[model samples]
Target: MTSNPTSSPDPIPNIATASEAFHTGDELRERWRALMGPLGFSERLLWFAFVDTTGHILPALNQLPLDGPPEPYLADLLMYRLSDVIDGHDVVSVAMLITRPGADAITPWDRGWARLFTTAADLAGVAIEPIFRANAVDLVQVSDPRADGRSVA
Candidate 1:
């Protein structure tokens, strides 16, 4: 008998677990609250991967998949890859967030960041956004000034 080269085994190593599945906003909100806990700017404020969609990749207290690749482990690599995609013409589905020092706030987009975000979104073909509220502000993107049909910031 010939074994199939492209077959997933029972214990598929790369398959997403139930917990690894995409999280809804509500579910993520609960998780975020739990993560935030009672620490008032005491714990590290960072943006772990939320729903990285063409819509919005929220950077806040959100339900992290109990089993997804941790942010730090993939941040640098993800950024480099994203840059390459923006600079190159490869499979351009991109979404990500950055960690910063704050209290349940996202790293606001500056002029430099706006350029990066705008470029990435344009190259990404479809669309991608980083969503988060800062210091009780309503949800906002990285605050880009350009209207590239992508960076709604």
Candidate 2:
């Protein structure tokens, strides 16, 4: 019997467990790094993980398609889903990651998505932490002006 080389094991060895605390931006980035593995995706994806005011992460972490649907519709979808988990006690915040297959540099496109989400979260009255971006080279905390609380168009 010959073993198949094509069938490789998953690269991500460990993932964040429920209720794990992420108190700061650095900690959140580390968790994103763990979740993202070596940073490479064939298509664009937006990853979401719920966190509480005390920094404890909720059990739900999901990846959604980045394309299709208008931005407002997508934002509405996200807000609707988030409302189910939020109780204003245990689950009060969210963290996001935008990933794609490309160079590590942050792009305008990335900023646009971040801005849109930031605006949506604001309107929905949800607390949002700093968003992050990942590509073929690196995972980084998004530092765009929009993400920093500037108006989103």
Candidate 2: 10-residue stretch with minimal lDDT: 1-10
My TM-score estimates for the predictions, one after another, are 0.32, 0.77
The Cα local distance difference test for each model comes to 0.34, 0.71
Off by over 4 Å in 2: 1-20, 68-70, 146-153
Top candidate, metric TM-score: 2
> Could you say which candidate leads in lDDT?
2
Clash count for each candidate, listed in order shown: 1, 0
lDDT per residue for candidate 2 within 1-153, as digits (tens), equals 111356553244366532456766766776777767766788888888887767866666798888743377787678767767777777777888888878648887787788778778778777778888888766777786655653211
Q: Could you give candidate 1's per-residue lDDT for residues 34-129 as a string of tens digits?
A: 333332332222344333333232333222221222344333443544454442233223333232334343443323443544454455443444
> lDDT, candidate 2, residue 125?
75
TM-score between candidate 2 and the true structure: 0.77
Task: Give candidate 1's total backbone clashes.
Answer: 1
